[model samples]
Every structure is written in structure tokens, then in C-alpha cells.
Target chain A: MGSHAERKRRDGAQPSARVPSASPAAAHAHRESMPDGAAPAVPGLIRLQPSSVRAAAQTPLHLLPCEIQHNGPAAVSRFFSPAIRPGSSGPVVSFRGRSLHGEEVTLPSGYMGLVLREDKSEGPEDRTVQAIGTFSCFTLWGLEAPPGPNARMHRALSWPSLATAIHAPVAEEDD
Target chain B: MLSHKKRPAEVHCDQWVLVAPESVTDLPGKTENGPVFTRLHNPRTGEAALYLFDTNAQQLFEVKAFHEEFHSWFIGQTVQHDGRLLLVTPVDPLFMVLYYLIKAEKEQGKFQPLDQVVIDAEFPSCSMLLQCAKLRPFLHHVTEEKEIGNKKFYKYSKEKTLKWLNKKVGQTVRALKIGNVNVGARVSSATFVPGDHGSDVKEEDYICYAHGLISEYIPKELSADLAKYLKLPELSASLPEPPLKKRKVSDGPVEAEEDYTKFNRVDLKTKKTNSKMTAAQKALARVDKSGMRSISTFFGTKAKAGK
Candidate 1:
């Protein structure tokens, strides 16, 4: 996977659609034409668009137990919404002849979860993580019973906290 | 130097729900230094996943996604039918530095400056790890460093690395106690196998869980070594981890697209595989496969993609 494309980037420039090349504008050709220079593009960087970051808010989300293998529109209200029922332990949502148990999982403290949309005009090499929405918690659904601490995601949600300790700066006093 | 460039054949779009530190929002004015998200090889797995470098803060964070089937987001204006919840957390830069030092030991068998040793033609952004201020003080934990004329050259030391990993496991165990993590629950990921967790929790379970967590950052061989060093009794049989190796091949470092001509080509080739998909498959792909990252990443240890 790392063949010729490696060389293309090292050369400092490649013919790509993202470059403002269509205008045939020369480097520094128009300081008068534009006051601020285009942000120097960092190759392979995706940034959070500042304006979009401001738009982040609490968004409702669900994590289904089965893989959908798709990416576009869906009739969630018709097929999925009316199926959620309160069970003894937690919420149970039925779909495809299966009962899915749901539990709420929250992001670790000081971290915000945002639904990001790529600003379409930004090129692949350098793009921005434009936040369309945000969420603090989501329903994590699993088969049979809601996922306990042992569930893949339940354990995954514990990672950031564990990582903090594993990666924390070691105290100098340890012998 | 600004000359005309050619158009890329197609565009790449990524839309995932991301978790980031609050400070990342401060990135608008400072364009020069990025809160840049790039790809780096997962130190343990040698696979590439998206990593974020907030050079402005001189901090490094790793981004991983949590996805399950049939998940979707309901944002303010629309229903984002994607299945990924990306989590970004600060990662110790030393974990990555240790990767290079070990590789350097195998290749050159001698001391070399960090710049020379950490260079990767594929993941050029790996050099950005050097900007992490913690690298200098922490380098000695896993390497033997010699200073000459103000430049430090480093050689790998497994003994020290194991010692450092031991401390990591110890601290992770401590965090587990403080967090009151359900220590007796069955654990997944790392080299450890699934064992019954219904019994009472023991001190060893915490240690085992901690070691499994730390293993996510180091190589499997080194993980075996660390387990031995920690005197962790062999717990269970390790299974064939096919997804990580496959991920390594497909998810090349962020900069290392196999062929640029595929993007730079004048004439675009469009695959009509979508048209052939059954309606259910097509609709499902649209509703379910919204995560920009691969499904393999859903399991968090994809940081190691093992266990």
C-alpha cells in the first residue's frame, strides 16, 4: 500500500484537485487579492472545523447488535421506533425476530463525542472533522441481556480511563 | 512555486462521531500547527489507524471507533445512519517510540538519534511524535541513551522495556481498583483468552486484566515477554487473530495509499458493484455501514487488534 504515493508527497507538491490550481494563481501572486493566505495544508491531516465544533450538542444515538452493512437512509421510525419496550433490567428493542437489550454508555469525562461530517470541498489528504452533532451518551444494545462490563463495548468504554493510568507520567520516586 | 496541478479522480469523504478533549476546539486561529489527525501504525499490531496530533498542545492522542450493527445517530437536522463512535484519548508517546527503538535494534543494532530511527517513508507523520515533549524524559525508560555534543542516540533494551511495562501493568491495576471496574468480568482483547468471570475477584485477576490492557501497546512477542517478566501464569490459548493482519494490509498508514495514479489518473474508473447488490444489501450498506473506519476497529483493542 505504501508504494509510489509515498514519493508523490515527499516532493512537496502533487497534481491534486484540492490545490487552488484551477485559477492558475501563482504563489504569493496576489497579497492584495486576498488578505489572509490559505492555511498551509498539512498532508494527511483531518482537523475539527472551528465553526462546526461550535455546533456540537447532545444528539440521540443507538448502537444495534447486528451489522447493517449499509450507510444511507433508513425507515427507523416505521420499523424500529415502536419496538422499544421497558424490560425488568433495561430497554429491550426488537428487530428481525430478535430481542435486543439496551444500556446507556457515556463518553469519558472531559471528552466530547461529536458526529462529524467531512467538509466536502476539503481534499482527502487534508480534511476537517466538521461536527454536525454531538452526544454524551447512547443506547448500547446487545443480544439477550444488556451488555455487562464484559461486553466488547462496555469494556471498550473503560479504555480511556485505563489508558490514562497506563500512560500517566511515572512518578520519579519509585525505586 | 504554486503551479497548476491535476485533478484527482475521486473524492474521499469521512463522517464519524468523534470524542476529543475539550482543548481541540481552540484550533481555528493556529493553522500552522495542526490538531492534525493522521494515521500511524498501531505499535502492537503494525496496523494503521487514525491518530490525532495536537501539535499546538504538543500532545498526541489515538482515535478508535466503537461500532455495532444497526446503529445510527439522530443529529439536530438529520438522521446520520452511521455506526461509529470515535474515541480520542491522550496516548503516551513512549509506546510509539518504543516501537521504533525495537525496530531500530533489529535493523541497525546500534544507537541512533530519534529522528533517524523514527523515520517511516510510509507514515511520514510518525516524525511528529518527536514533537511530544514527554519523549525526552521518557526515552530512558525503554532505551539506553548516549549523549554526544547535545544529541542523544538511543539503543533498545528489553530489560528496561519490560521493567517499564511492568510498571504500566501495576498502574493500570491500581486504576482498576480506583475506578471500581468489574474486575471479575470476562475480559476480551489482548493476548488473554476469555475465561469464566463469575467467580470472586482475586488480585491476580486485576493483574491479568491490567497486563492484557498494557499488551495493547506493545508487540505480541514483547507482550509474551512482559507476561513472563510479570510472572503471569499462562492463562489460556491464544487464537488466530486474522482481522489485525488483514487490517494491516488494507489500512496502510494515512499517507501511504498504494497507488497515487489511482487518484491522479485523468480518467476515473467507477466500479458498478453497487448496482449488483440486492436491495436489502444496498439499503443496509447505506444505513449500517456509515462508519468511515473498518468494522474490525469496533473492538477497541484494535489498538492492538489482538486478544
Candidate 2:
């Protein structure tokens, strides 16, 4: 049974290699190589559906939220984190304390974290972590694990508690 | 818990960048590269610092490190950014009025709203006014005329308005050049130059002409010689009415008994003595009586003995 499973895995890998080689450019060249033939004429008797006409019209691209993947720290240093490897399927994991629509989240102890979002909104990006006091780094969901040595030690904190600590009004001293 | 004094070198330039509007993302997820930030040059301090705005974060950051490290000279002058001029000074009523006036002009399509109010209101000295005048001719050439009043009364366009303002300033400078008004003096002199024809004259010549005209207009108290050159009327005719006659009082020897307290003592005593008598008795007593609302009116009748 184990040998059969291994054989199946090897076959699957071979098909994947051939699939990438069938490029659009190669197909186009193959079509050009064929002998010229008279194309079949369309019949005027058939009426085109309005849905087909509508489909031909250009529609503005509607940006939609897709999968979010956690990339390693090397990717994070390059400003790409939890790398959403292209074609992955799952909603992206959002940062805590940051607004969903993109706005600034002031961190405690004068620390400020900026969450960059796909949606362009005036003002700050949503979700923010003002200041994670005494923590080097925090955990994000769906990440395999904290990235290597460089990933600072961070404490996972609730959004509200972090906000309360950061935005707490300063008390005045009696002179 | 690391605390360090933020020095100029320690200032994080990366945090100071100004965010461009379009690079924002729609999802709640984080982006690796945010919008670009630009550092502004502080002319006074000769320092540069970064600026940024994050829409997703809805926060403006002026990175403390930058503020601590750099010397900023943005004290009095206004700063321009993102299609708006940031006024550094506190908004006073006078500034508010001027701001609205400029806003009105902008709404009328005459001037760009974002243009800085270049006129330095602090200490508008004469030298500055003169400098403004030096730029007048160029201003006048660039001024465009616009119809303002009924029957097409021509007025200066924004360019023309600025130009005329510059020329008026130059005229002031020329007027100051002549020995009419001293620098720092509270007083100002007005000059008028006649339109000259058939003469090749430089701009300096116009200044000289203006100076001479202003000198001529100076009040006679300041320059009698200037008054003579202008041939102004010397004096006005006097009125012909005679002075009024004086009145005289007699110095008499009839020697009527002089009782200085006659009215107060005798009259009041007589009135008190006759209080029991009827109204007929008071009417019969011969006291020079007159009804007056106040004591001042009664005493006002008597003049000083010498006068």
C-alpha cells in the first residue's frame, strides 16, 4: 500500500511539470503552424442574446478580499508579512488593534503601528496596535510559527485593553 | 523599557514620510510597502524632516525622533502642503477676517486659495514698502484689466492688483527719498507725477519726479521753501465786525444799610415769625421775592462787587 501511494505521488508531480510547459505562447505557435483553411461563416438567422452583448462590455474591476497567508520574517523585512502566496485560498488574517477599514491605532508608550490595507480610505488604515508594552512581538493567526531569531518576543494583547492603556488620559498633578 | 534622548541622527527618517493618497488598501490586512513619505525643508533651521499620513490608521505621525533631532524654524511663516497652507500662528480676529476675504476672492475665481499670504504683517517698515515699490514696473506691465463698475469701469485683475500695489509701494519709496519724511517717522508723504511726453527718461527719473512732487506737497510748517516753490496762498482775509460795548455799574454815596446777611437772616426770621399768620400776611411783606427751582438760580442774580 505504501509503495502504491508513493508511486501515485510521483506521478502527480510529473503531471505538474508538464502543465507549466504548455505555455500560451507555445500554443499560439502551434496554431500558426497549421495549414490555412476557410473559416466557417456564421448564420444570420440566429439572434445574439443580450446577455452575451452585456458580457462584452467592460466592467470596472471590483476589488475583493481573498486569502491571507503568513510569510516568514525575511518576507516581513521586505514589508511582506504572512506572505499571501499567490492563488492561496483563505481570508487574510488581519492585525489586531488596527481598524478594518484602515485607520491609525495609537500604541501605548508613544509607539505607533500602521496597518496597510488593500482598501484606499482617507485617514489612517484600520487595525492598529498602539504600543505593546514590554513585548518584542505578537503572534498572528494562520502563521506556521514565529519566524526565526529576528522575530522579537511579542505578547498577544486584547485590542480594547491595549487601546485603554495607550489612550488613557494623563492625570494632572496638583501644584 | 528603553529610553534614549532622541538626537538628530537617532531620528527615524523612515517614520517621517508623507503618505500619498492612492496607495491605501481596502482589506483589513497589512501591506508590506505603504505610501511614500516626503521630508520637508525647514528654511529657518535649515533642517529636513519626513511627514506622513496613514488613512487606514487615521493618524498623523511626526515621529518624535525627528522632532528631537532636528532644529525647526517654522515659527512665523506659513507652510504649504497638500494643496493647503498651514498657518503657524494662532488665528486672531484680524487674521480670520483676512482669511475670509482671500477665500471670497478665490471663490470668485480671481486668486488661487492656496497661495500664501506673502505680505509680512509683522513690522511693515518703510524699507520693506520701498522694496515692494522696486518691483512695481514689472507688476504694472503684468497687470490685466477687468471691468468692475457700471459702464465698464476697469479694475485690476489679480495680477494687476498686485502690480498696482507694487507701484503704490514704489511711489511711497520715492516720496521717502526726498527730504520730506524721515525714516521710522509716523507721518507719510503723498507724491503725484505728471504724465510726461517726448522725453527719454529712465525709471530712476520717474522716482526723482515723484520725490520732487512729494517735496512740493509737504506742509508749509515742514518746509517753507517748498511752500514758496508751489506758490500756495499765504493767508486768509480777516472779519470786519466791531467788538461789543462794556457795561458800567454806579459807585453811589446814598449809603443804604449794608446787611450782607439781609436776605438769609431777616427774610427767614420774618417768614418763621409769620408762620402762624395767614397767607395774606406773607403776601403783604415787602421782600423782593421770586420763584426759582434752585438756590443757584436765586444767588446767580448778584454780581461780584468789583466786577
TM-score of chain B of each: 0.70, 0.16
Q: DockQ winner among the candidates?
A: 1
What's the count of clashing pairs in each model shown? 17, 60
Worst 10 residues of 1 chain A by lDDT: A27-36
User: Distance (Å) between predicted and true CA of B79, model 1?
Assistant: 3.1
Writing each residue's lDDT as its tens digit, candidate 2 over A1-175 gives 1232243344333321111111222111211111113221210011112222222222111011111111111123222234323223322323222111111112223222221111112112221111111111122222222222211111111111222222222222232
Q: Could you give candidate 1's per-residue lDDT for residues B1-307 as a string of tens digits?
A: 2443322211122456677776664445535444667767778766555578874638888765554323445334334434456667778999988888999999999999989999987677788899897777888889998999998899999998888888888887888777665444334432222343334667876776677667667888998897788777773322113333333454323322211112111121222332332221221222211112222322322233222
- Candidate 2 ranges beyond 4 A from true positions: A1-106, A109-175, B1-34, B42-46, B55-60, B66-112, B115-307
Indicate which candidate wins on lDDT.
1
Whole-model alpha-carbon lDDT for candidate 1: 0.58
Error of 1 at A171 (Å): 2.6
